[model samples]
Target: MTTATRSTGDDERSAGNDDRPAGRAGARGVLSAYLALTKPRVIELLLITTIPAMFLAERGIPSLLLVLVTLVGGAMAAGSANTLNCVADSDIDAVMDRTKSRPLVSYRVPRTHALVFGVVLSVASFAVLWAGANLLAAALALSATLFYVFIYTLVLKRRTSQNIVWGGAAGCMPVLVGWAAVSGTVEWPAVVMFAVVFLWTPPHFWSLAMKYRADYERAGVPMLPVVATPRQVSARILVYTWATVASTLLLIPVTSWIYVGCAVVIGAAFLVMAQRLHQGVRRGRGVNPMRLFHLSNSYLSVLFLALAVDAAIGLPVLG
Candidate 1:
């Protein structure tokens, strides 16, 4: 899901409906506006990491009902974070072309309502996880929401070029939530999965930042591409891409050759794409960093899917 290459944690996707309506039309428009606030696409990306983590922890399929409940809790948690992020970033959203139409910027939704809604969603996520999954999962889910809202949105986002690097930790919590849901604790494999997402976040986000460099510059967000040269940005992307691929291989001790084979083929593709991006940036010819951005999404999804599939098949390389 990379998203929620889904979002950079700094900038969320904006989908806004027109305002200036009243009656039933107003009600529908408001509903749609609220939905956009949640960043549903971002939630889906987080979920992609989640269920697979469950599979790996279970070493096979987990209970269907448990999966269903965890998904609900996780989605609500992600939504809470995204909604609060919109509230916090509305000022910049108004400035960035891509986010100008966001509900908050467009006045389709009120900041106060969005704030209350975000809080409600967080509470609901905690209640759902605690009742349906476990306390550990619930606590982790709520902690992720808080981190995204407080640390990413309020603390680092506008102040640093490295915002996404540290902020991306919130996104990695789903793996912990998933693993804890299954095994009731975090273990080495879960941390390995977390590292994969943590390493992957910057490249995925920076590519988009490169594509939207002017928007961030105008908004004064200090994203790496807005603050650094293209060559430097692409260089770091290559380094993180290398780390991402290596992190995937860290699971080899607990996974089968099938996982290893998938990692090799797909990791090669990821590195090759990142290298091309670097070379293109270095050469000064027009470069399409977005190619690597889109591939980052697929790279994370496929890597985690391999984790799930290898676990479900019960084939082990070590022991």
Candidate 2:
């Protein structure tokens, strides 16, 4: 779901590096435009959480082929949802400084073509997941796509400041899809990991939103930072950051000292950074939200990587 525009959805900003107009360029340029529509970096972040869930479910390495299939299907599902968001949000994207380079806004590709591409990817994701994994996995992947497109993009985004909080649940579905791919059902440990990402989404996006508060304000999007004070926003980030760390510990029942050790250290760093941001905002000193923004990305990456490694080495703390 990228916080659900990452379209996390961190506005799923454009994959293209610069805002230079594409202007219906050649085949390679056209191809790149389509790729940008998928929001590859955000998809990459979503998948980072996915594989570790599979590892945790299997309690070790899953079949490499299963990992491959799930990643492909999950990427397609996320891609379809993100592309459709581009079509729906192109108006605000054109107005927003952070998103002006996106494919739909830039006219590098036709809107109708991007829409078709999105729908096709969803269908393909279902087929691939159904055939290669289980129907449950396929269904969960499709549901995430539908929720992100219909609920988050169309319904809640412009209407509420708490938009990303609820909308980000769609982004958490990859963990469900991953766990279901291996075990064929959702379990509590999987649910805890889902909670971690769900909680992680807000602070992650809001930090970036702090960096681009004016863009959101200009587009009339009621992002928390746009509507709330910097201190208020950072306070909320601290709350979510604390909850994210607590959720990581919930995996304690299923994980070993390895995972526990990593979670504690990384989570401490997350809190330190978050607290620093909060203190800075409170004091009206120079606060770089982007520092926490970049750190949050690395934090989730390291947390999930530790989970995968803990699963791989087969060191469980409990039965």
Task: Give all candidates' CA lDDT scores.
Answer: 0.93, 0.94
Which 10-residue window in model 1 sums to the lowest lDDT? 12-21
Off by over 4 Å in 1: 1-25
Query: Please, what are the lDDT tens digits per residue for candidate 2 over residues 1-319?
Result: 4333354223324535223344445666888999999999999999999999999999999999999999999999999999999999999999998899999888898999999999999999999999999999999999999999999999999999999999999999999999999999999999999999999999999999999999999999999998999999999999999999998998988889999999999999999999999999899899999999999999999999999999999974753
lDDT by residue (269-289, candidate 1, tens digit) is 999999999999898889888
List TM-score per model, in order.
0.91, 0.92
TM-score of model 1 relative to the true fold? 0.91
RMSD of each: 10.7, 11.0
Q: Score candidate 2 by lDDT.
A: 0.94
Clashes of each: 3, 13
Top candidate when judged by lDDT against the true structure = 2
Candidate 1 pairs with clashing backbones: 2-5, 3-6, 4-7
